[model samples]
Target: MAQTAGVKPMAIAGRVALERERCLGMTDAERAWRKQWLKDQVLAANEPVHVEEYWKERINPIRRFYRKPLDVLFDKLTPMLGASRAADYRVITGKLGLIAVGVMAIHYYFKYHGNDWTKKGGWRVTRSKPMVLPGQPGFPYKSERSKDSDYADRGYSKSSLFDGK
Candidate 1:
């Protein structure tokens, strides 16, 4: 038998078609059952090997679908500025600027005005007094016996106990 040029492998095509068919043929009951099964599998096992395997199997396709476009964009942009300069530009302009803007915006919005949506949702603004340590001036420190004081009186330092020594 002569093979046609530009034709995909039969097994590969068949597998794709089978997958499509299986996806298409999934009834509501089957989907619900699978969802319940997945939930059960996730809940029953602290470390879900099967779910992890399923996710791992999905990774390549998900990566290919999502990362491929970003990779293409990167490849296209890289040469215009050269790789090193492009990478540096991306880090400084893209990552750093995003973080800086996010921090500044959050600081400005929260500091100047309280969150509008939260206020609209009937949230009341409450201020908590700064917790002052013992012997600290200005704010009055409570003399209540706390866990720290109890631990300190036992002749064991808080740092030492935290270090497991």
Candidate 2:
């Protein structure tokens, strides 16, 4: 006999399918307990998820470190800032934290990954050594063009590549 107002057969089937993976390698007793725990966790619509005893025991102590200080801080601020202003400050603090994380991520990218897009080796000009043009003082007229020439070094040589060096 089917109960129209209670848990459906499909819900049980879905839960079994989901839990099947988790149930693998578990002892028979442990599997049974897990299934029972999951069934108990399933509740009617509009109810918040119930934290299990194990998780609550582990998290409570860690949560207290921030929870107590924040509670006291907000309580003290509520009179001076008012409830709305205090809530705004809380939202602003969260946004500032997100901005800080974004900045750090960008800094990490530029520091570690920026070289991939950048040109390599001797691309920048040195201001200390100004160029000496021909017909001006310190110009080199004795220089013969070769592989060591600026033109050849820049890959603009007119020589045919098929010709052996």
Candidate 3:
């Protein structure tokens, strides 16, 4: 399993050692009683954990907003793969998962960015006014706009069409 995941055995053993050490008042005899069993437990805990839990936590809740055609296949997979293979599957599926998450984030961003669903719809990246917190500077908005009018038209992103010299 470690080989499949590209994790060295020594690293796994090191983690197991750390786990064993974290147990307060654990005597050497008890600690060594079943090192292999303890190691296995720690190893399992360190992995992505059972696959069903991963799907429930990461995927299923978003079903209302986003449903994919392959979701049915993914949902039925645990019956064949079993929970033990879930961690490995998580590693294997990580790239595809990342792409899916990225796409979803982009979708949400474009969908909610302008508050288009609301009555007042304007394409604003952020509110122009700053929410004042106690002890912070007043209306201290972050901007790349130049303090000087001369430099304003000199910058790379010349969004403004003004030619004031």
Candidate 4:
């Protein structure tokens, strides 16, 4: 490093202290100018790279390949469906969701209530086990000789459900 004309040689610690004092003493405008000058110097030292153009060049072929079929489909449907409705994602999503839900509901109804519509007795809904309420015989625990051994069959059935464990 070149020495200043009027500056005296000093230890590294003394130089650091001097720099800290000088930085603390600078005005807001001087600090801002100094920051900008340093940034400009850093920018000037590095070569510029066109990141957006580079990425676009790399991705253009893949995008074009995938988009052609979709574009053609859109073009064909635009006039028939009305351009606005054809392009509206919300409407398409809502209709698709409704159809999916209807299909699932029909499937579950057949699964739970048998698909035998021509039967004499008609469809019968499958029954689930009854829920045991608080203060009931099997409120949170089952007795050793309980008629239903659903819970008692398991070795650790004495655990209290109310205790959150």
TM-score to true structure, per model: 0.27, 0.28, 0.22, 0.23
Q: How would the candidate models be sorted by lDDT, starting from the highest?
A: 2, 4, 1, 3
lDDT of 4 by residue, 1-165 (tens): 456666876543332235776666877766676667556556543466558678667778787685556557766888888878766743565568679999998888766655233343535554456678898887775444545543323323444543422
What is the per-residue lDDT of model 3 for residues 20-116, given as tens digits with 9 covering 90 to 100? 4646556666557547656566555457556876666776556734445344545577678875575457556766877999999888876766433
Residue 5 accuracy (lDDT) in model 4? 64
RMSD of each: 22.8, 18.2, 15.7, 18.6
- For model 1, residues 58-120, the per-residue Cα lDDT tens digits are 678766675455456666899898988766765565566669989999777766665333244
Collision count for each candidate, in order: 0, 0, 0, 0
The regions of model 3 sitting more than 4 angstroms off are 1-83, 86-123, 133-136, 139-157
Off by over 4 Å in 4: 1-59, 89-133, 136-138, 141-165
lDDT, candidates in the order shown: 0.58, 0.62, 0.57, 0.60
Tell me which residue pairs clash in candidate 3.
none
State in Å the error of residue 136, model 3. 5.0
Best by lDDT: 2
12-81: candidate 2 lDDT, tens digit per residue: 5343346556565666766687678778878779676557686667677767675555557777898999
**Best-fitting candidate, measured by TM-score?**
2
Which stretches in model 2 have alpha-carbon errors above 4 Å? 1-72, 115-165
For candidate 4, give the lDDT. Answer: 0.60
List residue ranges in candidate 1 displaced over 4 A: 1-82, 111-119, 122-126, 138-165
